[model samples]
Target: MEVNVIFSAILIFIIVYLLFSLSGILFPIDRTWYASLKKPSWTPSGKTIGIIWAILYALIALSLAIVEYKIGLKNTSITFMLLWVINYLANQAFSFFEFKAKRLDLAFLDTAVVAITTLLLIFATLQYSVLAAILLIPYLIWSTIATLLAWSIYRLNK
Candidate 1:
């Protein structure tokens, strides 16, 4: 691989992880508070959630680079851009809604939006690169799970 491509991937990785990290920085998880709330019996441990997100974020960055390279970001359609942006924002919003604002209902809604946009994003990326689209499957699956978990938490806590 060209050094430029390597650098591009690294840059994307940093930017993608930074978004997730920024949410953490701003609204760091309150383990005590979270533990006090009623969660589904099936809820994953904190360490497992961290590991899953780390992997998912890496896949997300890779998918983004692949799609951008295949289609050229300059030539990417507005629909793709919109879906990607919306998904990014909605994904980040979960931390704020759930941790900072302590609003389980909003977090559940945000997760739904994230899942919907992620599905649309996968469809949009298919036109550019099937691999890129495929890379997002884990994220979509996780987001759907997250939506369900969020709803469950809201119902149990509220």
Candidate 2:
């Protein structure tokens, strides 16, 4: 990869992860509130969630970098940009609804949007970069799992 490409990837990684970190900070996970909820047995541990999100964010950054290199940012379609924006907003909304607002139902809906946008992102990126599309598969799968987990929690609690 060219130096510029590597830098672009690094920058994307930093920006994406920083946004996620900021969301977490704003929500500030309420461990006491979460523990009081009726989560499913399959729910992952806190450490596991952290590790998985870190990897997923890295993959997302790499995928975006590949897309940027294959099709210059200026050339990306408006639909693609809209999907990315929706995905980011939906992802952030989950944290706000679940941790900050303590609304599991809304959080579940937010996660559903995240999963759908991730799927759309995969198909949208496929047009410009096969590698980028492939890289997003894990994120799509993870988002699906998260949506299901959120639903499970909502069902159990409600």
- lDDT per residue (tens digit) for residues 1-158 in model 1: 56666667567667876775677777889889999999999999999998999899888888888765554566789998888889988988999999989999999999999999999999999988899899999999999999999999999999
lDDT of 2 by residue, 30-146 (tens): 999999999999999988998998888888877887777666666899999999989988888888999989999999999999999999999999998999999999999999999
Tell me how far candidate 1 lies from the true structure as C-alpha RMSD in angstroms: 1.7
Residue 154 alpha-carbon offset, candidate 1, angstroms: 0.4
CA RMSD of each candidate after superposition: 1.7, 1.7
lDDT of each: 0.88, 0.87
Q: Clashes in candidate 1: how many?
A: 0
TM-score of each: 0.93, 0.93
